[model samples]
Target: MIHCARTDKGMVRTNNEDAFYLPEGEDKPLLFIVADGMGGHKSGEIASRMAVEEISSHINHSFLVRGSGNETMQIIKEAFYNANIKIYRTSLQREECSGMGTTATMALFKDGRVYIGHVGDSRAYILRDGCIRQLTRDHSLVWQLLEEGRLTLEEVRCHPMKNVITRALGVDENVDVDLVEHEYKKGDIFLLCSDGLTNMLEDKEIRDIILGAESVGAAADKLIEAANSCGGFDNITVEIILVD
Candidate 1:
């Protein structure tokens, strides 16, 4: 497996609230994550960082034992649950961090399959045979409206409440995480990113950029550059994993 990741504060944001995790050593389990935080002041930054740290720690400690597919999915769920509780508790204990929350999207590769755990508007996608498909749904009001047929895809692009996410880690005492499993093939590319990238570029635009790049690292750099060129309004983050 080959992977690359990038994050930027964007052209407008004074501070970046996005956080991501990419495994360093080949000995480590294959895990990647992207988080976008929300709140006042620097709390959003703290929330996102905490989410990545807590989730990575949980998975690193618990993922060593091999298990069935269902068991692995359960492990991923537990990692999210544990991180939620930690972030939520921190929000309650620190007045400055009150109401702080973050979107968490993670991909864990195991036994030729990728397990995804998601919350908020961040997304996970798979590219195979020169085609791209979204693997997770956005947990936001506009997405809900779009699903209900009350809003069209074109409307979602400029909706006033497009940034209003309905579900996130640390906002409430409990968080509902979405889980998905996909079998990957050689040469397949998996992407996990924050809305900063998606909000600035359309799906087709993203697909083209990745397909056009010469390497995973270059693709990540291009994605961030493209988002910034499109008037980056928020922090941008991208993680790309190529199965070999």
Candidate 2:
């Protein structure tokens, strides 16, 4: 079974632009999501909420939950795509929300396996055997530079456009999701988080907190607090999962 907990704090922002949900059914580890929305006047909040709700709804409505996809990757991809379309259509009708978009990441667990689908910069990571591995790529310009050797990681961090995301929900009608699978083992831990936390905290700092926290819920809380202790420049969201 999977035990999990998550949170979203708008921090200094006037409105919350992050959202997440932990759906309970069989009570096993499954379907955890985190979204960081972009826009103003509550549009970011709506976009993020829409992303979390739609993805959760899509997965809940699908029959794949029990059918098994151990070696398949299509289900994870479809869920993100469906959520993006719905959010796109929503912005079209609500002129007040035009141009709003969000970065999203989802984690799914079944039979000791973990599947992740992602877009934008939000990420999924696993900590096992005292090592942590990032499982998704950041679809941002700074990230592009880092990958292509155009910009250094340190430079990207302090860049004026550090938060300028290159891809997101409702920004384009079409989206590509990063899909990854990890074979779950006892004592493994997984985390899904928005860039808010990452933007303020270093990767090693995060790993240290996760390793030191007493439980998943504690880890989530401590991570949020740690980010705020720094600058808390934006909203922060995190999901921490433990498998047994």
Candidate 3:
């Protein structure tokens, strides 16, 4: 496995509210996470940080006890649930963090398959055979509209409410998480990113950049650079995992 990740505050945001986690060393489990937070003051930053930390801890502990098995999806779902409860409780205890929430996108690689747990608008994509396919759907109002056929793809891109996500961690005690499983082979590349990247570049552009890059690290750097070149109105984060 080959992997790399990057995060940037972008051009407009005063501070980055995005956070990500990537396991280090061969002894670590193959897991990756990205979060985009929302709230007042620095609450967004705290929320995102808390999310990645909590989820990673929970998943790690689960693997230690249960071992990776068919229950992997359930373990990931429970991790998200626990992270949501922790973030929500903190929001109620602190004024600045009130209503704080974050988008959580987690990918767990195990036994020739990837299990994805997603909430809010952060995304997961697979690049295989020179094509890119989105693995998770956006939990945003604009996405709902697009699914309902009420809005076109072009309109959704420029919609004023595109940033308004319908679901997020820490916003409520219970959150609906989307879980998916996909098989992977040698040369398959998986990407997990915050909306900051997609909001700036189209899927085709992302596929092209990943294909053109020499390494996973270079692909991450080029993706961030390309998003920043597009004005970078929001914090950008990207994680690339290549199956070797």
Candidate 4:
């Protein structure tokens, strides 16, 4: 496996509120995560950083909880839930962080499959056979409208409410996490990113960049560069994981 990641504050954001976690070494069944935060002041950064730490810690300690992939899936869900509760509690304790919340998208690779636990709008994509397919559904107002057939894809892209996510971690005492599993294949590539990248670059453009790049690291750099070139209105983050 080969992986590379990059993040930038972008052209407009004063601070980068995006956080990601990628484990090192030859640890099979590794974990990868991307988080995008929203709140007042610098609370968004705090929320996203807390989420990454909490989730990564929980997953790392869950090694003793052994079971099949289905059982492992449950553990992954629990990690997200625990992370939510932790962040929510922190928000409650800090007046400045009171409505702080973040989007969490996590991918766990084990036993020839990738298990994803998601909330908010950060996304996961799988590239196989020279094509890219989105894996997670956005929990945003625009996505809801698109699903209801009330808006066209073009409208969703430019909608004023595009950033209005319906669900996020730390928003409440509890959160609903969506989980899915994908069968991994050799040569398959996974891209995990915050909405900053997605909002700035179209899926086709992203696909083209990744396909044309010489390495995963190059692809991550190019994605961030492209997002900044387009506007970079938010903090941009990208993670590229290539199966060997």
Candidate 5:
């Protein structure tokens, strides 16, 4: 079984605003996703919910992502693009949702490999042989500054504009996403999480937990707990997968 767990908190706000879920079924294979929404009004709920529902609907028996077909990167791009359009159009049709946007990170498991599609800062990580690697690049200004050598890693994390994302769904009609593919292995585990969790826990800390935990649920709980200990100033969301 590929274990998955999720939880969200309001943090300093009045509502538990963040949303995430695992696309469940015994169909082709397992696909999991996490979305973090941003909005000035109550549209945060609408944007994240729209993203999850659209992606889930698009993946159900519509595409044959198995065997040799599983390696096709173009299929992954189109599916994500459709989801972006679905949410963007929905936002355009409403007033409260006008300024809404969300960060999304999702993985599709088929055959013996996994394909990841991501936008904004929500991230995907693969853990194998007790090593953890970040699989998605953050589309944010701080990330751009880091890449340009204008800011150090330590400085970038705490920058005032660190939360400002450069790209997201529902903000524009066209979106640029990062597609990542990795072959599978026995005892491999994958984690999808929002920035709230990463903001408090360092990469090495995540590696240690994924390595030491007895099960995927335990590992996810430990990660969220670690973030809460540091401050929990924002909502935290996580999904863990163990491939066997």
Candidate 6:
């Protein structure tokens, strides 16, 4: 496995609310996480950091104890659920972070399989052969509109409420998480990123950069650079995992 990750505050945001986790070594499979926090006065940063740390710790301790297939999915779900509960409780204790929330996108690579747990609008994508496919759907109002056929891709781009996510961690006592798993093939490139990068570049643009890059590190850097080039209205973070 080859992997690399990058995060930038971009040009607009004074502070980077994005937080990510990429664990090292082989004690367990690679655990890649990306969180895009929402709130003011640095609350967003704290929310994302807490979610990543909580989820990473749970998965590190419990991953090997669980069986594969449905059991693995359950373990992953529980990890995120615990993270949500922790964040929500913390938010309740603080006035500044009262409604703090964040998007969580996690990817686990293990034994020829790929599992994804997603919430809010952060995304996971797989590039196999030359085609790019989004693995997780956005839990945003605009995404719901798109699903209902009430909005087009072009319309979503211009929609004022495109950033209004319908679901997020820490906002409520519980969150509905989307979990998925599939057999991974050699040469498959998996990407997990915050909406900052997605909002700045289209899927085709991301595909082109990944295909043109020489290494996973280069691909991640190029993606961040591209987003910054396009005004970089928000914090940007991306993780690239290549199955070798």
Among all windows of 10 consecutive residues in model 3, the one with the lowest summed lDDT is 61-70
Score residue 101 of candidate 4 by CA lDDT.
97
Q: Highest lDDT, which number?
A: 3
State the lDDT of candidate 6 residue by residue for 1-244, as single tens digits.
8899999999899999999999767776579999999998799999999999989888888887346678778888999999999899989999888889999999988778888999999999999989999999999999999999999988997799999999999999988989999789899999999999999999999999999999999999999999999999999999999988
Worst 10 residues of 2 by lDDT: 63-72
List where candidate 3 sits over 4 angstroms from the true fold: 64-69
The local distance difference test score of each candidate is 0.94, 0.81, 0.94, 0.92, 0.80, 0.92
Over the stretch 1-244, how does candidate 2's per-residue lDDT look in tens digits? Answer: 5556555564677666888878667743368898999876688889889888888877766636456664336766777787788888878888988888999988887766777888898888889888888889888888988999989988988878777778887777899878777788888888888898888987889999999988787888899899988878788888887776
lDDT of 1 by residue, 1-244 (tens): 9899999999999999999999967877799999999999799999999999998888887885578888888888898898899989999999999999999999999888888999999999999999999999999999999999999999999998999999999988888999999999999999999999999999999999999999999999999999999999999999999998
- Runs in model 2 lying further than 4 Å from the true structure: 27-29, 65-72
Best candidate, TM-score? 1
Global lDDT for candidate 4? 0.92
After superposing candidate 1, which stretches have Cα over 4 Å from the reference?
Answer: none
The alpha-carbon deviation from the true structure for residue 171 of candidate 2, after best TM-score superposition, in angstroms, is 1.3
Worst 10 residues of 5 by lDDT: 65-74
Q: Report the number of backbone clashes for model 6.
A: 0
How much is the lDDT of residue 189 in candidate 5? 86
Cα error, candidate 6, residue 48 (Å): 0.3
Count steric clashes of candidate 4. 0
Deviation in angstroms for 126 in model 2? 0.9
TM values, all candidates: 0.98, 0.93, 0.97, 0.97, 0.93, 0.98
* Ten contiguous residues minimizing lDDT sum, candidate 1: 58-67
